[model samples]
Target: MYVSLVCRQWYAVTRAVLVLTRPVVWLETTPSSQLLPQLENTRTLIIKRPQSMKHTTYVTWRDGEIQCWTETLNRLRELSIERKIKINKIEIKRHIRVDTWLIPLLTYTSLSLTNLELKDMVHREIPFGQMMKLCPHLVVVHLHYRDTGYIDSICRHANKPEYEPAELPDRLRLQSLKLDNVAIGRTILMRILRLSPDMEELHLKRVAKPRSFANEWLNTDDRAEFSQHILEQISSICPNLKSAHFSYYICDLRSLASEFHLAIDRNLFPEVSYWSFKWCDLSADTFQALKTTPNILTTLEIIDDASAEDHCQQHLHEFLCGAPNLLHLKVPKTLFSITWFDLEGIVSTVGHRHGSTDSTTTVSHRKIWACRNLQTLHIGFGCEGEIQESAENTRLIFGYLSKVCPRLQDLTIRYSLLSLELNRGFCLLTRLHELRRLVILTQCNNDKAWNVDWISKLITPSLGARMKHWAAEYSTMNLGIARARHPFTSTVKNPLLHHLLEPSIQSTVNGGDRRGDEYGHAANAERRKEGQLSQLVPDYFINGVDMRNLGQLEDIVELLQDRISKDWQCWPSMGFFELICLESDPNGIEPFKDTIRICRPDVEVK
Candidate 1:
C-alpha cells in the first residue's frame, strides 16, 4: 500500500527539511524568543528590520523578533553556511493595519550570499541611486510596488541632497531585473539603463504610462511621437538586450512600430533576435517599420483580438511583404487570408525587382520574390476560401523559390473545403515535388466530401514517383450523396424503354405526374387514390418494371475496373483507407469496409 502526500503544508515542511538546513537571520530592533537551532552551524547571517512589530502572525516578519526566534536563528547560523532573512509585506484589511517586524541576528559566519531577495522596504523617501548603493552583491533584483504613487517616490528619493552610489555588489554582475507594476518615470528608466548597461535581461511590466504630450521634442504627431519616444528610450537603454516583452492595458501598433523603426535606425541591437507583439494594434505603417528593423529577427508572433476583417488583412499583408527575414508566423484563426499572400513579384520582373536580396535565381519561367527565408508556415482557420486563394497564389510563388529557399521542407494545409470541384484543385501541388511530407487535415466537412476515387485518380500519379507519404483523412460527415437522389440519376435511366412506357402510362392518366419527376407521364382516374391527385400503380411497378433495359451494377463495375486498370498507378496507395466517426454501428461500418476491402484489402475501417 502506498500513501499519498495529501497534506500540502506537511509535505512542504518535510521537503524543505530534506533539502538542507540554513540559518534563520533577521535584522530588527529586538531579538526573538525562539531562535532557529539549525542556524548554529550556518556559514552566514543577515538581519533586516521591518517598519513595525505589532503583529504576531507566524509567517509575518514581526514573528521573527520573538525570543525563541533569536535562539533558534542563532543556533542555525552556528550549524550551516547560508542565512536568509525575509521581511513580511504589510497588508491593510477591513480598515485594520497589520504591523510587520524584523530583528537583527549578528553572527561571525563567513558564507557569501550568492542570492538575495529584498521585499517591503520603505523606499518612499530613499533615492533610487541610494537604494542601488545598498545591495552590493545582488545578482537579481525584483522590485514590486503600487504603480500609482511609486515613481514619484523613487524620483523624490533620487533627488535627495546626499549623493550615494548604489550599493549593488557589482553593477556589472546583475544579470536579471524584474520591475512589476511599479510606477516608473522616464528619468528613473534612464537611470536604470545607465546603471545596468551590462544586464542581460530586463522586464518592465505595467510600468508607468508615458505623458500624453511633450512640448520640446519634434515629431509631435499623436501616434508617431509617443511611439518614437518609447522606442528611443529602449534602444538607448538596452542596446545589447536579447529579448524584451512589453504588454500594457492597451497598446497601439503605431507606437510599437515607431520603437522598432528606431531600433533599426540606431542599430540598437546586434544580438536581439526574438520579439513578441500581443494585443497591439497593427497597421500598414507599423508593418513597414518592422521590415526595416536592423537586427536579425528569427521568430515573430502577433496575437490580436480585433474582429475587423479588413484591418486584419491589411496588417497581415504588410507584415508578410515587409518582414523578409521572418521564419515562423502565427496569426489568429480569423487571419487565414494572410497565408494566401503571394510574393508580389514571383513570376514577373515586377516581383523580382521588389524581391529582397536581389537574388536572380530563376526557373520554370518563375521567380520567388518574398519570404525566401520562410520555412515553417502555421495557420489556423475555419473555412476553405482563404486556402483556395492561397494555393492559387502559392502556385506562382514557388517557381522562383527553387534556388532561393532550397532548404524549404514542410507545407501544412488545414481547412474544411470538401467540395468535389475544390478537392480536385489540390492537384496543383505537383509543382512542389521537393516536398517531403503532405499533411491533409480532413477535420472539416468539405474534406470528408472527397470522392476517394477522385482523389486517387487525380493526386497519386501527378505527384512524382519520388513522393513517399500519403495521408487521407475522413471527416465526421461523409457528405456522400445517394445514387437515386443524384442530380444525373434520371439521365442514367433507360432512354428508349422510358419513352415507350411514358405513352402507355399517359393513356390511363388524367393529369400530369404529381411526383414532379422530370420525365414522368400524366396521372389518370385509374392511378388516383381518392383525394390524392396521383398515386403509384402498385401492379404497374411490379409487372411493368423496366429492369429489362436498365443498366446493372456489375456492368458499371466492369467499366470502372477498365478505367482502374489503366489508372492504378495514379493511386498507388488506394488499398489504404480510413473512415472516421461513421455512426459506430455494424450496419454503417460493414458496407464501406466490404466495398473498399474488395478493391484494396489494406483499407482501414474506423
Candidate 2:
C-alpha cells in the first residue's frame, strides 16, 4: 500500500499483483461500499466469533452476538449476490457447531462456491442435504471433530439434538472428502459417501462408531455387521476412488469394524496405487499377504505407535521381496534382514524367536532388495552381530542398495546407528547418481564427527554429483535454558559467551587439534600464527551455535542476551544451528536468491 502511493502506474501494478494472491476477508469487519475495489477477489473468507463471547460457552451465546455475525455476513451477501463478486470457497474454521452459522450463511452467500471445509465442529449434526444443494460445484470437503456426546457432558440439561435431513438432495461435483475423528451416524456417513459417487480420494483417518451412525443402542453385532457392509460396499460405492487411506481408532470398535485395513482384504482397495497407514498396528501378516497378491502399489507407509519391531515374521524381508513397483516406502523402525538374533534385547511373545539356525544360513538370507525402483526410502537400518560381521553386513546392505535403487533420491536415517564410515559403508553409496537429499537424525554428540571434507567426498565431484539438501537434526532436547559458566577464560570478548556456552578456558575456537580437522592444513597454519578466534573465526559462532564441542553437554543459547553479527543466530530447541551448511540455488528461500542467481547461476554455495 505504501509503495502504490507513488503513482497510478504503481497502483495498477500493485492491484495486478494482488489479484494473483488469494486475499482474505474478515467477516466481522464490514467495509463501506467505497472500498469495493479492495475486495475484487472474494474467493476465501474468514469469520471469527465475537471476542466478547470467547469466555462464554457455545450454549450460553446471546442472540445479540449471533445477530452481530449474521448482520456482518449479510454485508458480504450484498457484495456477492448484488455486486457480483462471485464466491469460490468458504471454510468455516470456527470451533462452534456447523449448524449454528451454516444455514444462515448459505442463505446469505452465493451458492456457486467450489470448495467448502468445515472441520472444527463441536457437535455432530450438520445439514449435509442443504449444504450440497446450496453449493453444487463443491469439489472438496473436509469434515472433522464432531462429537455431540462431548457437548452433552459439558453442558447440563442439554436437549437431545435433532439430526435434520442427512441425505443429499442430488449428487454434486464433489470429488474428495476427508472425514476424520468424527462420531457421525451411519445414515450421515452413507449419505456423504453417496453424495460424491465419482469421488477420487477418501481419507478416513478415524471415523469412530459406524454402528452408532444408525443404532440408538449399540452392540458387538452392530459393529461386526457394519464392518462387513463397509468392507464389501466401500469399493463398489466409490468405484472412481484412485487413492484411499483407512486406519483404526477406539480399539474395541476397530477390532470389530476396521478390518478392511487388515492386510487380507485386497479387494477393499482394488486399484489404490498410493496407500498409507499410520499407527494401524500392522504386523508380519500384513506384508506376507502382499506377497500373494498382484502388487500394484507405488507408495506404501506403515507406522507403528510403539515403533518397537515386535512382529518379526519376515517384516522387512516381505516388502523388499514383494513390491516390485514400489517407488516410496517409509516404515520408521529399525529393521534387520538377518534372522535368529535378539535385537536390543526386545524379547517379544508375538512372533517366533529363532534360537538356532542351520550352517547353510551363513549369508543369513540378506539378499538384494526387491524394490529396485524405489526413489524415496525413510526407514531405520540396523545390523545385529559381531563387530566385523556387522560392518560386512552393512557393506553388503549399502552395496546392494546402490546397485538396485540407483534412482533413489531421498534417504533419511539415524547418524550413529547407520555407522556410515567413509570407506566401508558410506563409500558404497557413490553409485547412487540420483541421490539428492540425505537427512540423518543424530542423537547428542555426533554433529562434530562429520566435516566439510567428508561432505565434499560424499558429494563426489568426479561424477559431477551434487547434493541438494543435507540436514542432520540433533534429537536430544533441553528442557530448561540453564545459563552455565564458561570453562575457558571469560575474557574472550564477551562474558555472556563464556557463561552461556561454557567453552574450555584452555582452548579458543581454532586452538589445538580443532584447526587440523575444520579446514585442514590451510586453516591450521592461519590459526597457528594468529592463535586467536578474532582473526581466524568470528564472534557470531563464539557461543551463538551448538557450542557443545566448544565444551558443553547440550546445545545452549540465550536469545535475549544477544550480541553478534545480525546475519546468524541459533535456537537449539527449534533445531536451528550454525553448522551443517545447506546448499543454495535459485529456488532457495534466502533474500539474495534471485540476485545471486542472476549474478552467478552456475556457482553453488553451501
Best by TM-score: 2
Score each candidate by Cα lDDT.
Answer: 0.39, 0.46
lDDT at 41 for candidate 1? 29
Error of 2 at 69 (Å): 10
Best prediction by lDDT: 2
Tens digit per residue, CA lDDT, model 1, 1-606: 434567987766654343223544544443444335323323333443444442222133344345544465455444434443331111121111112112111121213333433344332332344334433444555554433333323343332223223422235345566554444445445556666777666655444444422112211121112245565666666767775555432353224554554555565656566565553534455456566666677665555443335455555655654455777654433334312322222122231112221113211121122465665554433322233333223332222233233344454444333221222334333223344433443332222332333333332543322121121111111112112221122233456444543422312132222332344434445346464543543211211221110111222222233334454333333333343321223243345345434444443433
Q: Candidate 2 residues 562-603, lDDT tens each?
A: 112131211111211111212222122332223323333332
- Give me the runs in candidate 1 sitting further than 4 Å from their true place: 1-137, 140-172, 178-180, 211-237, 245-256, 278-282, 292-294, 301-313, 317-606
| CA RMSD, predictions in order | 22.5, 17.6
Tell me how far the alpha carbon of residue 441 in candidate 2 is from the true structure, in angstroms, after superposition: 6.0
Reference-based TM-score of each model: 0.38, 0.51
At residue 243, what lDDT does model 2 achieve? 69
C-alpha RMSD between model 2 and the true structure: 17.6
